[model samples]
Target: GAGWPGLIEAYRDRVDIPDGARVVTLQEGNTPLVAAPHLSELTGCTVYLKVEGANPTGSFKDRGMTVAITHSLAEGSKAVICASTGNTSASAAAYAARAGLTSAVLVPQGKIALGKLAQAVVHGAKILQVQGNFDDCLELARKTAAEHPVTLVNSVNPVRLEGQKTASFEICDVLGRAPDVHCLPVGNAGNITAYWKGYTEYHGDGLVEQLPRMFGFQAAGAAPLVHGHPVAEPETVATAIRVGSPASWENAVKAKDASGGLFSAVTDEEILSAYRTLASREGVFVEPASASSVAGLLATAADGRLPTGSTVVCTVTGNGLKDPDTALAGMVEVEPLPVDPGAVASALELR
Candidate 1:
């Protein structure tokens, strides 16, 4: 067996897949769980970053899209549809192209990051920018898929979670056990729900002796779970997480309750600070929404709420390149240097 089999091949003996199905893969799993020394020192807790941006499509959504598209092809579906902030569409479009199925993506108008948008478009997806929020796009996608002969590849599809759950398996395999705590940026809430399910299944089957407490964080302006009500006009600089309502709301709550975890909110300012910190301090660059977990971690640490010396893993969901606009706004530009070596030395103050 060659090393680095895709998730389906890697876990085929453990989980269910379509019978006799050819593995459709972009090698979406087996991301690095890099240690975050600075974060660990600051919080007095051991922290590791689940660098999901290393996935083929530059986001964790590739995990779900792989399974969803594979299942759709096996089921003889000629087309697939999904609603996404950005990453989901890109993944779906790419996979659909591979599977020889049509893909359609519905997105919120003028909201998604340009990099993600470029992926979906280049992959030949039929993109619809609805003049509404993510919730509205999701609703329309579901309705369209139901009324037509198309399969919806959103996280609402069980096959997507089946693929995504493998992330937990990888983590457990690497750690030799589950960490004491797992943190994530919650948008549609499906990720938190899927992770809790994974940990529970592994523990039940004796793969793990313990399970991590699921700590979910959301943008303050779009924190439906934290507020106990959906915000009609959710707004945040973390465009990936600008969801007013979560599809997996009840399941997310269940994960929190079952794991003795809590849902929390982080402001845009805090998210940006964590974004900058991850890049400058830890040399890990991630999108603004992906930094929400780190921001929440620091917030809890500052308030003396985090348990000291505990092992923790934060899922960074997307690449920083996905949202260059947020990373560049208000940053100082470096002036071009002259060709002369002396000019370069002068600019560096080495003279």
Candidate 2:
């Protein structure tokens, strides 16, 4: 209670953790809503970054995990299971460990980033490397949970989205109204759906006069929502969003249609460009997948799809540390200085 209360306690009336359940929390959520002056100047719109990477697990999944794990424990489930590209598994494992439940994560073999995999491993989750892709692993996790006593903590669970919707509330509360547009990277599509639900709920309650148009961006190589079809082989450098058959497909569609939102695809180059810009220019170090929102913003603005002078919020989903390999790729090796101050000054061109 001394620190910022976790999301559940912060939004007690809204977040539906099960009654009589001890709230399982890592004090996730209440992430920063930071201003992006460079992006605002570039696009002629007031831009803000919902830096979700600040969550306990360095990803937005922790927002939902707290609720899901609390529900799992209340339901008397001794274990929990999930399928993930990377972030979900880490969040689930950490939350499960906190709840004193056995956690099992099914991840695509060779797909998850090392940092995320390490998080799950260190949290003591039973890791199973599936031979198939993420969708396959999710299906397997679903079936296993249905047959066993283990609870499924994936976004497919309604409670997970319930917890995630609080993000929209936080945004609205901070801005005093919904933004004109809300941009985010769409993978499993749960986050977009949750944000839409939250915004609409706020609008329904007269907390805001208008709702934001959702702009969901997917990796070009794995853009099932953009294509309006499931990809058999989804591939992208942004592994977090490398989903083909998104589990929340129908709800995501509804969110898009209802909110007058549009889904688009950005290439890996664009994603990486935005990723670097975020770190180098904005002082925000987010994973490549998280930069997809910024990529979408730039794309939409250039194409005249996004209106100028509008208020926009982009959700950067994960911390850059989640994928150190991507950051270190093609890094230049600098010649070591001979322990000389003059050499350093010469290298800096200050001589």
Count of steric clashes across candidates, in order: 0, 0
Q: Which stretches of candidate 2 lie over 4 Å from their true place?
A: none
**Superposition error at 197 for model 2 (Å):** 0.7
lDDT of 1 by residue, 263-317 (tens): 9999999999999999999999999999999999999888866799889999999
Per-model TM-score on C-alpha atoms: 0.98, 0.99
- Candidate 2 Cα lDDT to native: 0.95
Q: Look at candidate 1 and tell me the lDDT of residue 266.
A: 98
Candidate 1's TM-score reads 0.98
Q: Could you tell me which 10 consecutive residues in candidate 1 have the lowest summed lDDT?
A: 14-23
- Per-model lDDT: 0.92, 0.95
